[model samples]
Target: MINVDNLSYSFPQKDLYNKVSFTLEEGQHAAFIGASGNGKSTLIDIIMDPERYMFDGKLEIDPNCKIGYVSQFSQLDKTKEITVFEYIAEEFIKLQNEIANICTQMETSSDIETLLEKYQEALDAFDAIDGDDFESNINKKLNLANLNKHKDRMISELSGGEFKLIQVIKEMLNNPDLMIMDEPDVFLDFENLNSLKNLINSHKKTMLVITHNRYLLNHCFNKIIHLENMEIQEFDGRYIDYNFSLLQTKIELQELAIADDEEIARNEIRIEKLRERATYNAEASNGRALKARVKIQERLEARRIKAPFVDIKQPNINLANNNEIEETIALKVEDFSVAFDEVLLENVNFEIKSTDKVALIGINGVGKTTLLREIFKNNNDCIKINNDIEVAYLSQMQDEILNESNTILQEFYDAGFETYREIRRYLSNYGFGEDRIEQKIESLSGGEKNILQLAKVSASKANMLLLDEPTSHLDTYSQIALEKAIQNYNGAILMISHDYHFIVNCMDYVLMIEDKTIRKVSMKKFRKMIYAKHFDKDYLEIEQKKKSVETQIALALMDTDFERAKILSQELEALIKSL
Candidate 1:
């Protein structure tokens, strides 16, 4: 168990927390949630390394308990060459070394009995901690993450998402009493996210996860810890329940404040009347009455209710409608094949209708981002776009578009807005206040950078948007706001995201990239198919067979083999109808 009391942290510029307190009991799974830059990470840092930071707080943790941490950013040194298996088995390797050392001591020591006792003790400790089954357990988790094939691959060779999974697996292998994960869902795809959720649910340890993924928060955590407005608020249920309770509390506070204001006004009026009467009389008795009335008014003022809790204002994103264009297809890809030493995708074909909102999804290290970038390559014969359409692309790496040296105000102006009022109005829609406008871009958090890029994209007035991981670092509220904006957008959107909720809310179609092919399906049908695949093995096999046939058909069409394409088309039709 860990107890935190009166935790306060400050930087040279701002005070993040003030007298915040919370507790994490043994075996409790809790979620930490708040807007970006609200000190959620700072609180974790203080807990993990109290001496590194200067803060006033009382953190009481069980001395025997071990902590395992997975940071949002990669902590591994990419330059070092370490295989996935070696990394995950590091803890077990250390235990083995200790046991071997005990054996060596037994062979050399004069006090042979003492050495033998120590050796037995070490062996027992190893067995008690499941060290004997370490390899099997690591393999099982790696298989669950669909990374068994890459067990021998160097960590440096893996993609960011893959490496993140490895880090999570490594932490789990430690079997720590307390697991602290920060934004673990940022890099996970849908399948891996499910695996991670299942792991968290089954683990018999205390957990404190900081994430903006609503599904994970609602399903995996039994408690919610909200860090907002320099305070930490604890709730006893899931995220949805906590959110509802918070809204109700805000409403109640508002009503009480309104009543208090009215009563204070009435008291002040009565006090003024008494003062006027006393002045006219100018007598000792009247003076005494005025004093008494003044005291009563003071008491009433002292009893006035405090105002309601108001969240920081987030930006209001209002994307401009696309200009009218005659082209029905905003983008079309045919016979698209891409390779980087090995084939990532082949014979991929899809079309984005002018009014369509399409999502691109696939497993980690697949060709989702590759396919999106291929369109921008412009030299590829496979991709074609309407001549009059303007395209705006938000890459997964947000820094590609942001200028680190520029201030927020400067970046907004650079996006084509002329006046300060215009820029401020646009920034305010995204939750940026006057104080944040002058801040340098480099100092902004990841979520803030995402918002800035979104604001720029909205200002572009482009008819076609190619967004890669657009919702990655955004808070729940910001994500919902972006979804609403996308819903109202008249332009075409071809986005690559792992956020199932955002995809369902904003996208009309899904372009799933798998097995070096892209298959298009409606959002509703995709959801149903994934649900079926999860619960029924027979259904999953059928879907896999259908996908295989579809891929064959796409390949046949690309080769202009009309006869083969016709036969495969009939087979695909029959398969779908049967399902």
Candidate 2:
């Protein structure tokens, strides 16, 4: 838990926030949403005390906490090039060193060897709790996000989406009591996004998430903190509730602004008159009159001009100009297969249309991304469409589009924007301001870079948006905002995300890609399939057996009898449940 009181932080512009007071409780999930450059990141940094930003008031963190922060990206030294296993194992080594120091302090005899063994066990136990399910957890999450099949590969070799997976995997392993995740969903596909949201739901710790992803805010967060008008305010609702309410508030603010100006004028005239009267009788003013004069001065100074709230809306992209029916296809595939030494999947087929707003859906490692790429490649004649469809790709891992040497604005410019004004306008839509546009893209977090990449694509004037897991790092509000933007987009959208809410909200059709195959289903039908899949007879039967047997085996593990351990182990061979 942490508390800030009467907090005011400043930059060269207006106060990022002023006189703000709030508390983040131990078990609450706080989501921060704002138009770009309203100081969401600055607030987070201030909370974390990263930049040593000046504070006007107080920030108090719980004394009994080791806060685990998952930054938007992994910024390891490139020279290391570690594997996932190695990366996680190193944490245990650190734990080992800590235990050694503790044992050294508690030393009593030459039996220190025994202490070493005990400390080793303790450290091992520490890692095992998180590492036990880590293999399956990472693989399941990666496959869902389309980042599997590369787990054994060096971290440096991972694509943008893949690195995002690494970042998530590392964070999940920490098991922090207080998790500060920035754009935790940036690189996940729909199933992985769903898995991520569920994982966040299961966590029993406090979370402060900064994202623009609407789907996350809608379901995962219990509180919404909107940054507007140089102050922070909390809304008790989901992302959708807060956003629409915010939109209405923006309208109301404009009316308030009009009324505020008139009030200010009247107050100024009153103060002038009061000052004139006080000036005439300065030497003989009594207590009541002096008090009245002081009160008038305070009232005149208190009426600060707060800017009316403005919605950080999306760009109005126009691509629908077709007057004739071009019953052609955009992508064709036949016997499109991909495999490792072991076959993940093979022999896929699908077609895309310029008019379709489709979602790529599948469980992790079902080859969803592979299928999308295959569809884009040429295979056979059954698929018919215009070959000239310009695709705007927003990869789940923004590293693909992000260049360290390039500033955020430079990346857009490099994407072939003709002018500076165009670049600024595009960045603004993604919540970036003029100050942020010039910041290095690589310096930006995974989520910030992602927004920039999306802005680049939108500014590129592309008609077919080939989005591969764009919801990974976005906060819940941003997710829905994007969903709304996509819904309004006339261009064809081929998006791959694992957020169920996202897929359900923005997509009109579904593309189920698994085992190197592709099948197009209606959104309604896909939902039905998901429901039936969960409540099937086979699953229900196994689930019922698990509940009854798990308790008995756990009890056996607690017993000292050799026969009981053997018998219980035989009766329930699997200790960990699949679900």
Candidate 3:
């Protein structure tokens, strides 16, 4: 449905795309993935409105095609006081209002030509969205997303994740020829994220999504459009398959690179000997041999192997803890109840021991963020923190911790850095280049802002961390690095996250909020819950067996029992095949 050929675009700061070509056919769901600040959103904007850009490219879009876009930063005005249905139907309402206004004007004004043209345009737009059935379509979308009960609720009453899903419903109901969503799954809770995955899988039209969400990436897309180093590649397969192929290719390339390095080393030694001999002998043949050796060395250097799509820069995320609290409880909450218009959580109790890595999880708008903030403040009667434990907090909203107007250098300065050179050296570990250090925080991408937050948190040297949705805008590479950091941290962590992969990777246990109280769940039960909800019932059992067999194999190998290890290995392979 969309074809981009030899598209070359650049920003004032750097080149983004160079001769990039890709195609999205009808019914193809494509994931537009890349590192942060790589112009994924900018490309989407260009595709939506190519006339606004002056670039060398051929962008062919169907003439009759309609597009529905959900921007990453699009937000509803909470104070607008409109119902969810009214908000979703805003476009239909506008077209109807415009048609009515034009008809009224045409009846009195002498400018009949202008009024008629306006009326025709409004009518066309209205019909394009099937204005007659707009309400029904909205209801259908809400039902599909399992949000029909919230149709009459005020838009301001919705949580961030709820509102994000509402935006998806609105766009899906518009029945566009293609839907383009930018990071629509960024901060969604687990349930809402599942709803979104279902919506994507069930949609019968074309889609182009830009997200770093591994869950959605693995389950939703049939095509992958990867942008790296100003080049784009299209893969026509599942993300899991694509990842395996990339891994295989990377291994092959690394082997070739090692061989190339060895050959170059040997050639260098040979060239050194040839030159040494040529320096002593005045023979023409000796000089020619040295020249030939030098030429061969140059060719080897020029032909050195380099791995493709495997060198993307990853941030060095370090969450430091110097004071390791061993025996004391890091934090405690008892009989905590928070209320706004109504009681959200009541009589909640939880505690984190020193060096414990725990996840605080609940549905969106279940007061998870509020609870974390209260713990951070530590002024309430229901909260108690150990005197020896120093705390650092990472808020989900970047504005809460970062000054948008300040440059990276200035921000680090405010964070207690003594010198600009020191700040530059520190930020470099988080993938901030020298040229980007002077740029204001507002200009950085969402992922970059999160990286900056992590950097600041790391510098705090606190023994306890209260993190709220810490992985919200981090790209996949940064997310993985953050996972490793969390795993290696000696400090206690009470993190609120909806990322299943991250939670399983880094957290030792879960503190789940249910029915206005806290319930501690083991990782095994958490895995069971996830598997039952998102996968087959047998999946968890099979995974457990696989883990057991692998452990057995490892023990057998350590004991020098080769026969036992081979038997356990075969059993592990069988379990994996079942999965």
Candidate 4:
């Protein structure tokens, strides 16, 4: 129930929205997607608080609408020591306590008028959200998200993904008319990501989500609002169908562009001949012909195809090792146990050989990050590392490796860059512009920070890497590029990740945490385990087949094998329709 018309906004460094317009109607689940640093979050801010900005636009929000917003980077104050139930009911509890205090004051106060007015205000506010049933509502939401067991737990005890879902449940209980989430799926584990998908699917009210998560985009939204090239394209369909249509359009446009290129080449030759005749003959007729030919060439050039949406730039991530290590144990853990208040993992043992790429995976809050950090420190008696192997570590928390107070240039300098020019040149491959090189690292977006981590890690040239959730905040294009880099890295890797697609694409084997112990499994076994837990066994099988067919179709089309391409396209269509 919001409409934005003719909106144009920009910052001092770059332009964002240029006469962009879109609408969010009731019962619509819209995915707001775009490249990183393209003003998706800024637009959300403008919608939430328009008075803070001075821009030329007509934003018409329904006067009676209630909005709920979840920011991209939100953290709980663990020092407060509040339970999940109490945290979700904090607003209602405040209003209830205020009403009781006002009533107690009315018992013996001379300023009865003031007390009565304040009491009425508190009562009305409490009743607006049905405070009488707030506890029941909170319980129901927790049950719906399958988080009933965590209702009585302390907020500090929950994992990042669990806390995020708790925030969503808290917002839902507010009975908002519209809910907006900015990258709610950024760092969630697979199970938690699926929980979010189910929550979005079951939501009755309108929602607008800004995320680069392909899983959520495929499974949750009915509408797609894509911002590209400083404009908007709204599609009233599933993202899968939209992507298919985009692929077909790109192929057709490429064919037309090929023909146009050929025609332009011939036109250029004709113009050259006419110019030569005009110079030799020195006649008015020849000169006029040359002028006409030149105009035609200009017209053809102007009409050449330009596919802005089809051609998106990706970061260059090359994690190539500078030196090779002998075939030896890169890392080994023996009889290790980690605990804070209670044991989470016990008697765990694992080893990685030089040049091996292995994934250390488990559900959220299962000590994966903890164990990885301990290995990086190499101080524990139970852990062993080879002396010849150089190590690089990438933490999911950017602040652990990046200095927030330092500029990008300074950070790179600390990362061992020799000069400012060299730092700028290296950072450009990761999509950082020269204008942002002098800016503080704290000012960059989450996605930008993650890309900077990749750049820094690649520069280390270490023979061994310990990466934790390396793809958390990256966009889809950057994710693909990182996957390629990981696949080609000439080093040993022990990565902690919950991104199924990324893990399957990059790692060679799995070292999974199960029942408080570490166990290694083959890639084939890991695939089966995932499919059995998360989907039908045939789900990934069919998807792989469809991808193979799509590739074949593209190659056939490129080779001008129209009949073969048509056959493959039909097969692919059938597979998609079955899905």
Candidate 5:
């Protein structure tokens, strides 16, 4: 439980956030969403420990509550003395001990202050480290963060995904009354993401999350607190509800302001006309009009209408080109294996063709990204790439591409643009406006960087596109914009994405990566795995005999075997199940 009033923070002259106020109730789930680096993390640091950061504000906090945080960056000291397992075990003991002490105090009926002093000592230590049920806690956390499968290994050897998984596990064991996590979903796989949702469901505590995972945000959080332009706004309900409500509020405010402006203008004109009339009739009429106008304007201005909400909608870059590869292969991988210190994929063979939109699905440590890099030779992998091919790759992390000295405009120019104005215009089409173009590349939000990367590649003449989770952390509008662009593209595409909507819309093929091997499947076949086979199949002739056989049965069951149809359906299902 906490409250903040008139909180403001500035960097020398620029105020990243100024005068933000909000409150969080005990056991409530809340989310903070805004453009990246718009003081979201800075605000979180302040909330977690105000004393640590220099700021002017009156923050009312439950002094008794111990705060636990899982940061997005997941800064860790790998060279620490203890082994990773030993460290985890010690943390678990500390948390369990703290919980035990709390119970001990309650049993002895100690005074709140004495209990507080003892509890705080244990809690501080526990919160600083990971807590009780070390094994289960780690597993649950790793599962949620999608990192637990890598636990037996040394911390130093783990990948970025592994580190992120540990951070989530640490939070689970600590069991703080309040949990603050930033970007917790970046590395989560399907199963772990579900585990996290279950944990959130079971936990009876306050949760303050900063994430861009739309499904989790919509499903888990009830309150949405969005920050932008150095301000914060509270809205009831989930992401979709918040978005709709915000849009409605904006439309209403715009209408009200327009009406008020017209009224004020009319009043001024009436007053001027009355001033020109020197006669008694003019003076009386004008005086009445002026008085009424002043009263109306004062009432309107006094009627408190909070500033209307506005959403940051990204621009749609419609990428289209002449259809080049209609019957040729786009990418082929045979006996593909890659690793730094360990092998990721082994003896993999797959070929992607024109008009075959594909998705490479895999878990966190499975090297979905590494394979992409290997395809472009960004890393080492045993594979053969076709010489006569054009390709563009979108990386999972853009931090490596960042240059501190470059501005957004300059980056575009460096990427091979003619002039400042040309790059500025191109960026504007991808959501960077005039005000944003002059901003340094380092100052741009994560979403902005992603869009910029997409634009840069979209402008290239490459007909083959290899994307690695391109839609990760992007907002709904931006995601839709990207989907539209890909749909409009005439070139071949072999993409890797987890966003269900985007994958379904843009993919005609799918490659499920499991056990370091790629099991390629036509998207049409994958759809059948989920469908119930209701009324009948499409009129087109079926290529696969298995599907055709089932279609005939569904058609035959229209009358004679309606009752026995369900039984026959089970048999058909059984046949497919064998696959």
Candidate 6:
């Protein structure tokens, strides 16, 4: 169990948390959610180590409880030349070494009895910690991820997605009592994401997850802790439930504030009338009536309630609507192939209509981003676009487009606004006040950069938009607003995103890149097809058989039975060939 009381933190610019408190019971899973720059990640850091952040709070953790943490941007050290299996079984190897050392001491010690006792103790510790099952656990996780073939591969050679999966597998091997995962869904494909979900659900340990994936939050977490306006609100349900309840609470508070304001206004009017009468009779009266009226006003002031919380206004994204198109095809690709160190995509063919809204989706390391960049390059005849059509591309690294040295006002001006007043008015439409307009771009948070990019794109006169992972850093409300804006856009849109909710709501057609080919399908049909593939009997059977062989091989290797491992390897090869 973990408990926090009256936690507060401050930075140079703003206070992140103020008098926040919450408790997580043992074995409970919860999610922390809020807008970007509202300190969700900072709160996690404080909980992990309050003293490190110098936060003012009271935190309590159960003694001797182990924690496993997976950060959003964790990367493998390229200098460390270690195999995937060795990395995952590191703790078990340490325990084995300790036991071996104790046994070697027992061989020639003068105090044989004490040495024997120590050896036995070491063995018991190993068993108590489930060290014997480490190999099996590692193999099981790898096989579930269809990564058992790479068990002996160097960690430094793995792709970003593979490295992330290895880290998650290592954490699972630790069998920690508490697990904290931040943005674990970033590089995962749909199949791997489901694998991760199953892995998380199978473990009963307490978990705290921070993710922008609505599917994960709604399916995995039972409780929510929302951080807003330097305050925290706890809800005893999933994301959908919490959202509904929050909306209801906001409505009630708004009504109450309106009623209180009307009452205060009426009391003020009465007070003014009483003072006027007193002033008219000043010559004949002693001013007792005026004093009484002043006292009544004071009483009324004491009864005034605090106002309701109003959310910061989201930026108004207004995409240009261009209905005129001389050509029917906005974009077309034929026999498109791209290769770097290895072949990523091959023989892909697709086309986009003038007013089509299409989504490009594929597994991690399958070249979704590469394809977008290739299209933008337009180096060959394989890709074609309409003549004289303007295209606006928003890369995954969209934040890098901003000039750090320039102020927001200057940036807007650089985007082609003529006068300061015009730029100011445009910025205001995106929720930027005078103070924010003067702030430098370097000081802006990730979410703020995203909003600025959106504003720029929306203000562009381009007839075709290419967006790559555009919603990754946006808040929930901003994402919804963007979806609406995209829906209202009259031009063609071709976007690459892993956000399922955003894709389903914004796109009508799907362009799935797999097996070196591009297949065009409806979004609904694509979802059903993926679901069917996940539950196919033959696929499940093959996966189970491979998992069994992999587990056996791992156990044999752990026990130093090389002959047995060789035989199991043959069996694995045969199974693969049969599949």
lDDT of 3: 0.84
- What are the per-residue Cα lDDT tens digits for candidate 3 across 8-55? 998666788999999999999999998888888889989999999987
Residue range 334-434, candidate 6, lDDT tens digits? 98898865687788889998889999988766788788877777777899988856777776564456787898888889889899898888878776766
Please give the distance, in angstroms, between residue 557's alpha carbon in candidate 1 and its true position after superposition: 57
How many clashes in each candidate?
6, 36, 0, 0, 4, 0
- The per-model lDDT (C-alpha) reads 0.79, 0.63, 0.84, 0.85, 0.67, 0.75
What tens-digit string does per-residue lDDT give for candidate 1 at 1-579?
A: 889999888765467899999999988899999888777887888888877988887888887778899887654467868888998888788879988998888777899888778778878767755899999999988888778999998776676677787888888777888999988888678677777787788777899999987567757998899988888999877775676455445545655776788888887888788889887889898888878878887887787777654643356887775575764998989999988647889998888888889999888888787788878666788899878778888877767789979999999788888999988877887877776788888767678788888988888889888998988878756776788899998888999888766687789899988799999988778778667654344444554566456546545544545567567766766665565
2-30 per-residue lDDT for model 5 (tens digits): 89898888864257767889999887889
Error of 6 at 547 (Å): 40
Ranking by lDDT: 4, 3, 1, 6, 5, 2
Task: State every prediction's TM-score relative to the real structure.
Answer: 0.81, 0.65, 0.84, 0.88, 0.74, 0.76
Q: Say which prediction, candidate 4 or candidate 5, comes out ahead on TM-score.
A: 4
Q: Is candidate 2 or candidate 3 better by TM-score?
A: 3
Clashing residue pairs in candidate 5 are 91-130, 92-131, 142-148, 143-192
**Winner on lDDT (1 vs 4):** 4
Models sorted by TM-score, best on top: 4, 3, 1, 6, 5, 2
Superposition-based RMSD of candidate 5 using all C-alpha atoms, in angstroms: 11.7
* lDDT per residue as tens, model 2, 1-579: 888888888765345787887788888888877655466777778777634776788888866666667666655455667875556445655666777676775576577677778777877666654644655655665565445566676665444444555665566566666778776665555445665676677667788888765556657998888777678888876664564454344444554565677776776677666667777766555445656766765775576546444433343333333332344565555555677545655666666676678898776556666655644453535433466666667765567656778877677767887788988876676677787677766555455565666666666666677788775655434555577678877667788876665687788889887555678899878777765753344443443354335334334333423355455444444422332
RMSD of 4: 3.6
Question: Which stretch of 10 consecutive residues in model 3 shows the poorest summed lDDT?
Answer: 551-560
lDDT of 4 at 491: 89
User: Which residue runs of candidate 1 sit more than 4 Å off their true CA positions?
Assistant: 10-15, 62-65, 75-82, 94-130, 143-162, 301-303, 310-312, 321-324, 403-425, 534-579
lDDT of 2 at 4: 81
Question: Which of the predicted structures, 2 or 3, would earn the higher lDDT when compared with the native?
Answer: 3
Q: What is the alpha-carbon lDDT for the whole of candidate 5?
A: 0.67
